[model samples]
Target: MNIFDNDSEVLQIGALTIENGTDSVILSGDVEITKTQAGKAQAQALLDFAQALCAVFDELDSQGLPATADKDPSKVVMVNNPFE
Candidate 1:
């Protein structure tokens, strides 16, 4: 099953543990893929995980809050609270 398909705080697939945080999603653990059928399955799982992440980015872009590759922390601007 696709772990990102639910609202659970934590989800697991094989050897990976995905933690839903307040501002980020944490991924931990290791998945080993050997030269066997089982290994191919594991590789597919990894690809699914990556595709899920891309979906998230696409959703964000659709909402006009696109994710950027900017790595400079100084470029961050604090704006007035919109809820106030």
Candidate 2:
């Protein structure tokens, strides 16, 4: 599978799973190489992309974006709306 973000570039290229009673996620791209070589190269590229994404998430978590906030019971509020 190949995933592209809004920038419209090759963001991730990876192998897809196909099994019984399952639908495959088709990727739109030209598979212009030998199966073995293309699979190896794309797999490596996708791994690199995944690592980069993980780093970004880690950075965001470190910045304290309310993800680590304590669960206070008093912060919970209930609102009732009867309009149907």
What lDDT would each prediction earn against the true structure? 0.71, 0.48
Tell me the deviation in Å of residue 29 in model 1. 1.3
lDDT of 2 by residue, 1-76 (tens): 2222233333334333212111122244443334797777866765665676567557756976454547789989
lDDT of 2 at 53: 56
TM-score of 1: 0.57
Query: For this target, which candidate reaches the highest TM-score against the unseen true structure?
Result: 1
List per-candidate RMSD values in Å: 8.5, 11.2
Q: What's the distance in Å from true for residue 78, model 2?
A: 27
Per-candidate TM-score against the hidden true structure:
0.57, 0.40
lDDT of 1 at 11: 55
